[model samples]
Target: MIKIYSITVTTILLAVVSLISCSSEETSEKKQENLSTSPATANYAITPVDLRYVKLTDDFWLPVVKRVQEETIPYAIKKCEEEGRLHNFLIASGEMEGSVKGKMPFDDTDVYKIIEGASMTLISAPNPELEKELDRIITIIGKGQEDDGYLTTWRTINPKKPPAPWVNVVEGKRWESLTASHELYNAGHLYEAAYAHYKATGKTNFLNIAYKNADLIVKTFGDNEGQIAAVPGHQIIETGLIKLYALSGKEEYLKMARYFLDNRGRSEHHKLNDSYLSAAYSQDHLPVIEQDEVLGHAVRAMYMYAAMTDIAVLMKDADYENAVDKLWQNMVEKKIYLTGGLGARHEGEAFGDNYEL
Candidate 1:
């Protein structure tokens, strides 16, 4: 049995705070001083207090946070390098050789996520050494990116031979199979990590990489003549783009985010037929606004819900808000495990029959 972590609600709460804090106009003037950038002026439903304003002095959450900063962050970085997570980036950049060295197509995200976590730690506690280490990782990531801003190491290294045989390799081209390729999923993590780095250190290196890639995403996908009207097989990119929009005040990023969410489950959008690519597995069985049940990969559902909540408040769309509320009730009332562990079934890392846990 998969040992699931009991942090689903906590993750959503943190994401909600991160997203809502920026768009909230009611953030007090005193809180604004601690923010890396001025609190966004966009109208939102809940204005979360800035992390800098909220200190975790309590014995419970404080040590947990510090352990991540003091112990987990260092250990993870070492393992990533030792295990070739960092070297894949180097190999993709021609700094090394041989085939991809990871089990998953999206292992690059491990590095990005680690940096994101460390950056978040820096936000609460100033750590120059940790910040510098993150800079080193981001620099390597930038080197691995393709000229047009694509950054998936496996595809870039050998698209014809994906790390996993299950990934459909079509002419070794980028964006060929959005459903299983996980290209967008990697970018979503990159954007999240880069934005965190920016917030933590005021550095633009990683953020610029994200911006370039995001711009390409906006350029590549849309309802226009040449674009692909497709949604991600996995979610989280929508919320990531939304966060970028909140930070940069760029309407296009917000539009692309909304586009991804709106296009899900529509015949007009791309579809997949693989065993795991089914609509329900990826939360694409229905339009997000019409989705009531939190079906699919549990983490994907959480990310989508976070984005939906953001849309509800940012766009003031009552329908989206209502949909999210219904989904929340469904999870809390029926699906959630007693230990707060979600995704009870490890088969697809997905939700199970109501109250199966």
Candidate 2:
């Protein structure tokens, strides 16, 4: 029972807007926003995905895989795999933790679970060396973990755990928690990664480890009263856990995820505790899909809905999927930008309407 006290008083309002008008040509008044550095864009066209057989990968799975494996996970895995390395690699090896040229040093134990997950994508990616990195990455998670199955590089190093401390930390350079708390997102990612890895190689070790960690998360967060409401900052875990439930015949995972989804934006859990912290994170502040106009964080919103869709499918909940379908319709038909980027403004790093980006 995670309760976000911050946003309980601030009600989230929902309204349905008409979908974007159909048009053939790009708006003529467009300014050339320099996207030379953007990831290579494919035509944004996609056939309607039938999840029954094709196995609905996350909509952003491919781009996320490309970024995580080639860019983020390799460097992180290298540091994590090194002999007796203490910092989060999900740490950079031989790279200065305090310098400019090194990899982003995120040496927290809770965070590495994400690196493990990001590395997990190699199991599904097109690259062979990436596929090879999965086992080595898991080994790093195994080595760095505490005996209680607690593994977060940050917490491991900074032993004095603060309640919701992650939500408030701001570095001189950037939002530390944006990426750090993202580990939960990473954990969800890892869960997906482990499932993909295990299926790719017929090895249950990866998923088995995920089940262990997820059980811990579920146990601790299961039904505590004075905590945050709302959902995970990253949404993929819901889908990941749902997939796990579908495969393992486990109702517990689905139940826990349902708890996460149901409490989101509701006043039920947050009225007692640190609810205002909800302002620091947005997914906690609104009902899924009811926020028709995408607000708050971008990555968090999409992943959350993606997970919502997954659960809706598994339980055959038309209401949830209808919400997902509405939002999906909005994004595909109205909100998405030209390069397939969801959020246009980097400030909130969130979605803008079609042609608005």
Top candidate, metric TM-score: 1
Please, what is the TM-score per model?
0.87, 0.60
- Name model 1 segments beyond 4 Å from true: 1-28, 32-41, 55-67
Candidate 1 residues 145-209, lDDT tens each? Answer: 98988889998898887887678876888887777788999999998888778876788999999
Reference-based TM-score, model 1: 0.87
- Report the C-alpha lDDT of model 2 over 23-102, residue by residue, as the tens digit: 21233233112111111111112212111112113444446657776777667655544533333433323222522111
Overall lDDT per candidate, in order of appearance: 0.78, 0.50
**Regions of candidate 2 where Cα sits further than 4 Å from its true position:** 1-86, 89-133, 161-183, 224-230, 271-281, 353-355
